[model samples]
Target: MSLRNNPKKSMKLPLTTRTNQVVRRKLQQSSGPFPRQSTNKPQRRPTRIRTTNPMQLLSNPAPNDRAEEQRKLRMAQNRLSSRNKRLKRRQLSRVAKIQHTSR
Candidate 1:
């Protein structure tokens, strides 16, 4: 007997992205007025990602153009970090003042 005829005995496949694509293709083929497939290629998730230290950024730069872009991003990151530190300091000082005033 064909696997499709026996739903309970059908092969159990993992719900992977490729499996999803196959299922969708089958569904579109069976239905009338099938929805248009997206023109954009599906973005596959990266299998492996690399980790690098943020502080090592300036020391280990990219190619000239990319290096410049990295510099700009680093500077922006530094400014934001400093701004956050200042805000935290102010918050702590306010709490300290409230405690001192109440004592």
Candidate 2:
């Protein structure tokens, strides 16, 4: 018997394919040109340009500007800890070597 003739076998199609077919048919019906409307909206206000020098702006920072300082402090602390770790490891290995040689 052919697969198309089998009623029980035809019921096993995925749910998503059936939903997509329905959505595509609905979209095809709604595809058309939009109706025109009035375009008399008021013009937007222009933004004020700052005439002050950028260097002056940086010299006098805004109130909420501690993020950069905090980041630099964290970076410096990380570097110091990493250096201390390396120094401690080198000293450990040197002491081990000296002990081995003296034995």
lDDT of 2 by residue, 43-79 (tens): 7899655447878657655545556767888999999
Candidate 1, 1-103: lDDT as tens digits? 7767987655454558658888789888785534455545579997643337765644554469477887899999999999999999999999999999999
Clashing pairs for model 2 are: none
TM-score of 1: 0.40
- How many residue pairs in model 2 have overlapping backbones? 0
* TM-score list, all predictions: 0.40, 0.39
Global lDDT of each model?
0.75, 0.76
User: Which lDDT value does model 2 have at 1?
Assistant: 73
Clashing pairs in 1: none
